[model samples]
Target: MNLHSAAPRSDDRDGYLVSRRQAWFAFAMTFALMLFDYIDRQVIVSLFPHLKAAWGLSDMQLGSLVSIISIVVAAGGLPVALMADRVSRVKSIFVMATVWSLATISCMFARNFGQLFAARAIVGLGETGYGSVGGALIASLFPKRLRTTLLGAFFAAASLGSVLGVMLGGVVAAHWGWKAAFGVVGVPGLLLAFLYLLVPDYKTVELAPRVGHARHSVRSFARQIVSTLAGSPTVWWTCLGAALQLVVVSMIWSWLPSYFHRYHGAASDHAGMLAAVIVLCGAVGSVIWGVIADRLAVRRPRNKLVMMAILCTATLLVFVTAFGCTMSANLQFLLIALGGFLMMCTVAPTATVVLNVIHPGVRSTGAAILALFQNLFGLAVGPFVGGLLSDAFGLQVALAVMPAFGLFAALCFLLATRTYESELAKVEHIRLDVATSSTSPMTVSA
Candidate 1:
């Protein structure tokens, strides 16, 4: 009998079996840091009125402040994730969290546009790798069945963090000042960075040492990244689709408060509160869709991608009506809230698709690549383009036109469905082959 066909030993099984308590603890801490990461990144949205009043800045300039961070994030995410893969995800996260928190605090000291913009760029630099690495870390701790649900819940923190950032920024700036809003939101991240150090992390299974080469060489690492990307169509399509959908999401989050203030006759804080409610609806939607996607995946693996396509198509319709139609403020807000919910349905499933297709060794880098696309095409372009349009015509016109990108997103997802199942099968086959190979003894020929 070949040793290669033998079942995995008990110790091998034990290696993968982390305690449930430890796993949940890591998830909670990582989720909290993700929360703070966005709180610092997004608090500026709530301070828009104060910044505009103080600096006498135009909408384009204000939008650039938000877009610049995403630009930096897109540029920096890949390199940072590659470094994290080489060094250590947990350590990388701790350092990243500390840097961004400090940068957020530094924003309070800025006396001019250049200084504040530079500070925000630093915040982006620190934040770029956290999501990718954090997702990989969480994936390692849990079984595949739970991936979409956990990742969906994990990303939902962004919505919650954004809500608190905008709401708290408005409330705090109303009382103390906009600078105080920066300082208050910045402090918790510092504490969380240290707290994160205490969480246990599992090494990625595929990256662990094997017989042929105990450690990966620089060339091998480069090759792995290329192969990971080249081998997966799901990765490419999901990234593009998510990026397109995010255009709508970014426009709403970045400009909705301003839209309400300018068009709905609401105060800054009140508008922020209203926008926060809309974003909170997105948070709810992410969790709901995540659960739905998980169930769908079990029932029919291809259904997750189909669901994403459908959701994106639905988002286009609802947001177009919300923005395009003439309606009361209450009615508009409700429709926009519904659009927000539908917009986020793609989040968990996209992340799930990438993780499902890519090898575990390069999972973080794959996520970083997705981040690069999503940020570059979606986060970076959405707000800036919206600002330019708002300048040329009006904010409402800009928003009304942006939802059309969802049609492109939906098309990409539908295309992805064609190849997703086949790609998934390839991954499973490779995994089984690897398992069989790892159990076998090598033979040397003279």
Candidate 2:
């Protein structure tokens, strides 16, 4: 038998993994689910007006419909990701898709604010681990050279899904009712869940650090999981910092339709269509920025953090100018769209940075930790806090001030630059042993 080195051959790395076709096929399924995942989460945004008009709800109550999902997702993400690392990623994903899709469908039948809130919470429960699990699986199957771009593309689905959700919700609600939007988006994910089963998965790999040893204890795994994240100050700073950046993103995405509707006197459908353009810009930016980050890292990987800091600073400047001062509607829209793109520059890079320093065996867990920070501190907080601020200060002032958080996010990313090289150097090199055949089981090449 040929001996496998710690540095794996580019052609045969990531263990005995899927064929090129199978990799893309699996990626397609994962990508589709991710798209629908955000669709369900964001469909509520366009419906905010409808909800408030119907229930006489406060801004916080309306924002709660969106924020609750992220809250529950934050609470549940870690445990679900731990299970995914041990079990099958594909299987876990299928179950999650089904649950969330069903929960989304149920939203159509909710008769009260409390009932709809509960359903939305269930939607979050289903989506809890999907991002971390999906990211881990995507990393494992694709060539390492392509992982960052592909990961960026994968996450861009969230933005695209948001676009679809915001648009579809408005158009559907205009014709039929707000409830019909849930059913329309919900059914496609269920169909995709069944289709996800056809995607092949890699078997779980143990850390087993000892030479010639094939397994490690669960206690060690738990300890390693903690160390994988806690030991890396870069990861620590990235999580908190990236999350702060997302507060700006989530706030803009969640409220743009409302912003346009109230300020420009646009109808719901018109406002949603307008907001979709901005989100589409962000979706495109996520992929492009990932490529930019990757190329900049060719000479020095830590420059990725430097790029993120610059992007955050740029976002702050653009938004402060766009919303902080009165400008023509056309000019403000242009700048806000530009700011939208700048804010997402870190989305792909942050995931890349966190995954870079984590152990292969605990990558999903590491990502989950990042997700916890994002969902709990970033995604969950942005909308509700925006609502609180909107109620107190008005939407225009709230949005203007929100982008300033990106400045803090910039500081955090720069601080992470301090330890990035050291943290990256500390990661163990891994070689997986296995076959190209989809049917073959996985193994680590020692």
Candidate 3:
């Protein structure tokens, strides 16, 4: 295992891990892999309309498929994270990639809603592991100063994948049918799974001394979990804020294509094209935000989270006016693009906060738990509720509901400021107390 830190001291014998260039290279490679991951998952959204028509399904049934995948993935995150923490993270990611890729390809064989739903559920199961492991890897590879930027760039790949998946799924479905589209997009992922092995393995520094390290046990795990949670108010707040943020992010991702079709009277291809453009803008925004976030981190560690709150509030206002008002198609697209940018900003910042607060031993599990809540609240509920509201009220009315969600999210994030600061202070205070307690009494013996 390779260990890396931001600054190396003269006494440090293991200098291999401190190379920033190696870390950056790892970041780039992983970021590329992450793009395919996002593409593989999101291809479903664009394919949804085609699949619905092909299977002659209702909106609720389609929404159920999405809900099941998300809920299952959320439910599965913990176990996967446990495995990732206990085992090789790189190997875990490779396994997840392979499993999900196979599942994605299996969608081609589905002839009905039941079969298709099962495939998506399998995809979710595999993905649960991927996210936790990948996140932990990225966190370990980068230092605090660059953590947000690295994570942001890593997450920004999702936007690029989103654009390709949505656009390609649309175009492919139009020409070759949904099944073939799944086959075309899904097969490439299987190859990428093998490529995961090429990336270098890096782990966080283990503080325990060699040969005398404490062995892990259930009791220690319980203690670790409790301590980790109690120790980091920032982690919980980041989780909560991210959960609320996803309410809007999830709905938009799952249903935006449908929204464009409904409101703008767009055909499948045209709506997808526009949606791709909006997502592309979001990808660009994430990269820009990542750069800004890293720069801000030099001054304030929590600046990333602060950025999230600010962006969420700003986006909420923009969308509230755009969706609530009678706007033209052009104007609506512009507003959605703004909203997308802000929503995308949450991804990198949330990842950084979660990693920063947790211990390396349990980082994967912590990340997975975070993923679980974020998915449950954001992915599972957001789109499903959006569809339900749209069915009862209308599409526009359903979308209008998200501004309130944004406000709730912003509030959660703002409360996090105090919690995070207090928690950090407590950690420092404990360390100082321990240092003083250790050294002060020893002087008398000397």
Could you estimate the TM-score for every candidate?
A: 0.92, 0.94, 0.88
**Candidate 1 clash pair list:** none
User: How far does residue 358 in candidate 3 sit from its true spot (Å)?
Assistant: 1.2
Q: Please provide, for model 1 over 74-158, each residue's C-alpha lDDT reduced to its tens digit, 9 standing for 90 to 100.
A: 9999988888775677778999999999999999999989999999999998898888889877876676778899999999999
For model 2, what is the alpha-carbon lDDT of residue 442? 30
Superposed Cα deviation of residue 282, candidate 2 (Å): 0.4
Candidate 2: residue pairs that collide: 16-434, 16-435, 433-445
User: Which digits, one per residue and each the tens of the lDDT, describe model 3 over residues 222-314?
Assistant: 776677765676787788888888888777777778888877778887788888887888888878887887677668766767877888888
In candidate 3, which residue ranges exceed 4 Å CA deviation?
A: 1-22, 203-214, 422-446
Off by over 4 Å in 2: 1-16, 210-217, 433-446
- Angstrom error of the Cα, residue 137, model 1: value is 0.9
Q: Which candidate leads in TM-score?
A: 2
Residue pairs in clash, model 3 = 3-17, 4-17
Predictions: Cα RMSD each: 5.7, 2.7, 7.6
In candidate 2, what are the lDDT values of residues 206-258, reduced to their tens digit? 65545575556778778877766688889889999989998899999998999
